[model samples]
Target: MQVISITDLNSVVNPTRLAVPIDTEQQHFQLAMKQTCMKLPTEPLLDAHPQIDRWIMEVGLLFPKVFEWEPPQFLVDTQFIAKLCTKKKDTCVQINTNAVFHRNGYVNLIEWAIRHPVLNWSDKVKLWVATEYLSLPPENLKLTILALHPTHPGKRYEISWDSQQHEETRNWLVSVVTKQATPMKTPVASQVKSPFPVTTGADFDIGKIEEIEI
Candidate 1:
C-alpha cells in the first residue's frame, strides 16, 4: 500500500481551491473545508451541507409542482413561500403534511436553484450581502436591510451593541475586508483529475506511508 500527503491530493484535485495548506495539519484541512463550503458555487450546496439534500428531496416530494415550473418562477414562488413560512410559523404545515420549515429559510431557495439549472445562481449572492453592508458596523445592522424595499417606509433595524462585542466585531470585519481586497495567487501546476479518494482526519500518521497511489 502506498501513502500520500494531503498536499499531494489537493494538487491533483485543484490547488487554488483549498484555503489551507494541505501539508500543514489535519485540523486545518477541516477548517478549510468549512470556509471553502461558504465560498464555493451554489452547485455544491448539497456538498457544503449534506442535510440540504434530504431537505430538497422532501420538499420536492411534497411539492411536485415546484419542479415542473420554470426556474425563475420556481425561485420566486419558493422564496415567497419560504418568507411566509418563516413569518407565519404555521405556513409549512399548512402547505403539506410532509412540509417542514428551516430557520435558515433561504436555504430552500438555494436548493431550488441547484435543482433548476436555468436560474444560473451562484455564490455571488453571499458576496453581494458582504459588499452592500461592509461599511455598516455589525452592532447596529438589522437582520436584513428592509429600507431598500419600495413599499416600506424608511425604518431602520437596530440592535444593542456592547463595547467589547463592538470592538471584536470591528476587528473581524477589518480582517475580512482586508483579505478580500488582496488578490489570490494561483498555483503554478495545471489542474488535473484526482486519482485517489482524498480524506482528512486528525489521527492519520503522515510518515508511515511510502507512496500514495493517487
Candidate 2:
C-alpha cells in the first residue's frame, strides 16, 4: 500500500457526496437488525460496546448499499450487527459516530477494529472509521485509518512522493472515498498529533498520521 495524505483525499473526494441519504429499505433493515441483535446474548456484541451504537450501526448497515457492494448476511452466532458490514468478504469497515478524544483512545479503537473477530483479523483490509458528527452536511474534522497492516494498526501510512506505487495507492484510495461518501474536512497540520514518536531508519514510520479534531 502507498502512503495517503489528507490533501490527496480532498482532491479526490467530494464532501457533498460523502454520505448519501439513508433510504427507506436501509432504515427498515437497520431497525430489524438492531431488534434481532438486541435479543441475542453474545460476547461480540458486548465487546463491541460504544462502537456499537445506534448511528454507527445504521451506517454499518447502509455501507454496502452506498458502496454498491454485496450486503453481508446476518450471522446468528456473532450476534453483533457490525459483524455483517463486510465489504469484499474480507474487508471490514467500521464507522465511528463518536470522535476519539485522546491518542490512546484512538489507538485503542483501531486495535479493537483490527482484532475483533467480526472483522476476521484480515491484514489486507483497511478499516475506515468515519469519526464525524452525524448531522446533515457533516461539519467537523473526520478521522480516517490509512494503515495497510493491522498487526501494528496504529502506525501511520505515509505517501512517498517519488515512489512508483504512489499512483496505485492514490487510485485505490480515490475509489474507496468516492464510493463511501463520508465527508472529510481540511486538517490543520498544527493541530493533528501522533500519539508516539515515529521510529527512525524505516520509511513506514516516517510521516505522521492525521488526527481527528472535534
Candidate 3:
C-alpha cells in the first residue's frame, strides 16, 4: 500500500553500505543484493475475464519497457537501483515511469466514476433482470467502473450490460465471478495419539510376546 516514489530509493537501499567489502561476515549483504536483483512474480487477477486481460495487456504495451507483466515494486527493490552507482548501466527509467503511469491511471478512473452517475437502479430485481439479459463482446464491453455510493458509503454501484443474452451465458458469468471472489479453504490435519508405547534397551520385552498359530 506504500506509494514508493522514485526519489525515496535511498530509504530502501544505501549505496555506501553496499560498497563495503564482501567478506565471510558480509554474506547476508550478498544474499540481500541477490534478492533485490531477482525478478518479482506477478499475482493472478481476481477474475479471468477476457476483456480485462486484453485491457491490461494493452496498457502494458503502451510502455513495453516500463510496464512489464511482473509485480510492481518499490524503486529501491528494482535491479536498476542496485546498479545505480555501480559500473552497471542505469536502466531505472522504464519502471519508475511505468509505476507513476499505472498509479495515476487507476486513481483517475476511480475519481471519474465517483463524479459521474450514468445509470442508477433502486430495484434489485430489475437490476438482476437487466444483468441476466445483457450481452456484449469483449471488445464492445465498455470500461465499467464500480464505486461506493456517494451518500450510502456501505453500498456499491451495480454494473450491468445494455444488451440481452441467453440465461445460460448470464449464469456462467455469474458463476465465474462468484468462484473468483470466494477464497479456497485448506483442510487441516489432526494429531492422534498411539495406543501403545514401546520400551527401549533392557525395558524392551520381546520375550513377553506369545507365539500364536495363524
Candidate 4:
C-alpha cells in the first residue's frame, strides 16, 4: 500500500530492535528489499520474467540462511502443486534456502505484508507463512499484491486502499521506517521511476514494488 520512494529509501532508518531472524546483517535486509524494488521489471501489466528472479534474489540476500531452491516452487498448495508439478512428480517445494529454515525476519516480513493495513487480503490467523512461500513462489512484481500472507487456510480477504487508506499505509510506512525498524531513506524529492505500470487507477497491487540503484 505504501509506495515508498525508491530514492528516499536510502535515508530512512529505524532504531527499534528488529526481531527478524536473518542470515545477513540488518543492513542486508534493507539493501535487498530496496535493490529488489529497484530492479523490478516494467513495461506491461502481465510479466514476471524479471520480477520473480528479483524476489528470489532479494529473499536470498536478506536471508542467506535460505539457499536458492533447486527446483523453485511457483505455487504451494498440494492440489495446485499436483496440477503444476513437473513430470518428476516431486511433492514438496524445493526451497532455495537450505533445509526448511525459519527466521524471525522472514516471519516479520511475511506478517507485515499480510497485516499491512494497505491491501487488506489476508486474515489474523497465522498459518505458517513459511509454507506459503514454499507453496507460492511469487512470479511477478504485481504478485506483491500477495503482500498479505495467509492467516488461516479457510480465510481469504481482499481490500483496496482509497486515498485515505493509502495515506494511512504510507504514513504507517514512514513510522515503521523511522521508529519501528532500522531502515534508511533516500531523501524526499528524489527523481525515481514509478514501479507499477499504468495502473489506470486499478483496484489493487504493484507492478514493481521495490527500489534498485541505477
Candidate 5:
C-alpha cells in the first residue's frame, strides 16, 4: 500500500542502503506485478484460452538472440505502473520513464533521463521508471510472461505493445500476484527441538526417538 515512486526516493537516500529496501519493495510489487502481467510459465486464462506459452516460445526462437527466447522482463511492469498512476489510456512519459528507472536500480540514472527535452507529459517515459524497480530470479521463480493471442499478437514484445492486450495482461497479473509464496522464514535450531537426546553416549538415541516401532 505504501507505494513510493522509485525516482523520488533516490534523491535523498544512499544508493547502497536504497538497494535493499527497493528490492524488498519489488518483492512486494511482485504481487501487483504478477497480477496484471503475462509471462512464460504463464498460467491458464480462464482455463479454456488457447496455449499462449507455446506460442511465445515459438516466437522467441525466431528472434535473432540465440538464447531461444527474448525472455519476459519488466516491460510489462512499467506499462502497468503507467496505468496505475494514470486512469487515462494515454500514459505520461515521465511517469513511464520513472517506472522503468524505478523497476531497474538506476537510482542515479533518473535525474539524467528527465532532462531529455524530447520527453512529454503525455509521452509516458516507461523506459526510465522501470529501470529502478527491478526484481531478480522470478524468471526462475517459475513464472513466465507470454502473449494472450499467439496468432494475432505474434510474440511477447508485440503483444505487450498492443493496447488491447493491456487489460488482459493486467487482469492475469493481478490474479497470480497473491499466489507467489512469501519469503520463507529460516527455522531457528532452538525453535525446533531435535528428536535427538541432548546428552550423548548412553542416552543418545532416546530423546530423538519420539515413537518406537517394536
Candidate 6:
C-alpha cells in the first residue's frame, strides 16, 4: 500500500538503534542490515479474500510450502506486509529489517496478509491465517500452503516429500492439527484467539525494528 524508496531509508532506519550489535551477532545482524539497506521500491497490501476461510481449511490439508518454502524472515526481506485489525488502528504486521515488532503491548495477527512481493492472493491469505490464526510453525505452515490445489478430477496429492515414506507428511499433519483443541475462526474484523502463543522467529526486542518502519 505504501511506497518507500531506497534513497530515503537512511532517514527512516537508524542503524545505531539495532538490538543486535554487528560484532557479536554477525549473521543475524548482517541480515538485518542487508534487508534495511536493500529496501524494495514498493510495498503491496492485499485486500481480504472473500473465500479466505475456505482456503485456510484447504491449505491446512495441503502442504504447499514444501514446494516453495519462504520463511517469515524471507517474507520480511521481500517487504511483505499483512494488514490486520481495524484500518482505523493502522494495525498490521510490523517489522524492522531485523525482526517483527510488538505493537500495543502484544504481537497480533489479524485477517489481512501483510506485504510480501511474490505471493499470490491465495498464498497470501494462507500465510496470514497460518501465522495469525493457526499459529503454525514454519515447517507445519509449508504443508498447509499446498492443500488448495485446483479442483480437477483425478488430481493426485503427495502425502510425503520423501519418496520412500508415502504417508509421512500426511501423518505428521494429522498429529499437528489434531493437537489443536480450538477451532480456527473465520477471517473477520474482530481478532480471533489463537490456541497457542504465536511467535514468528522474526520476533525480537521491539527496538530492533529501527531499520525499517513498518
Q: Rate the local accuracy (lDDT) of all candidates.
A: 0.29, 0.28, 0.25, 0.27, 0.26, 0.28
Compare the candidates by lDDT and give the number of the best one.
1
**Backbone clash tally for model 4?**
38
Q: TM-scores of the models, in the given order?
A: 0.20, 0.20, 0.16, 0.21, 0.21, 0.20
The digit string of per-residue lDDT tens for model 5 on 1-214 reads: 3233435322212122223223322232233323323333324432333343343344344332222222232233333242233222322212432122222422211111101112221222232222212332112111112212212332222101223333333332222222112232542334323222222112122224332111
The 10 consecutive residues of candidate 2 with the worst lDDT sum are: 75-84
Those runs of model 6 whose alpha carbons end farther than 4 Å from true positions after fitting are: 1-76, 95-126, 129-194, 198-214
Please list the Cα RMSD from the true structure of every candidate, rounded to 1 decimal place.
Answer: 20.7, 18.7, 27.1, 20.1, 22.0, 20.6
lDDT by residue for model 2 (43-160), tens: 4543554323443343344232221221132221121112122233322233322122233323112211211122211111122222211121112222232222222223222211
Query: How far in Å is the alpha carbon of 138 misplaced in model 4?
Result: 27
Candidate ordering by lDDT (highest first): 1, 2, 6, 4, 5, 3
Instruction: Give lDDT: candidate 5, residue 145.
Output: 21
How well does candidate 5 match the true structure in TM-score terms? 0.21
Q: Give the winner by lDDT: 1 or 5.
A: 1
Native-to-model Cα distance after best TM-score fit, residue 180 in candidate 4, in Å: 37
Cα lDDT, model 4, residue 46: 20
lDDT by residue (1-214, candidate 3, tens digit) is: 1222222222122222223332331233223322322443222331422333343343233323323333443222221111111122222211111111133222001101121223321111122322222222312222222221223221123233334422333332233233323353531111111121211112223234333221
Give the clash count for each candidate. 2, 5, 2, 38, 50, 12
lDDT of 6 by residue, 1-214 (tens): 3322222221122223234332322233323324333442212111232333333333333422321333442333333343343322322332222122233222222111111212232232334333443333433332111212112211112211122221332232223323222243442312322222222212243223232211
Tens-digit per-residue lDDT, 73-106, candidate 4: 2212111111112233322211111122233222
lDDT of 1: 0.29
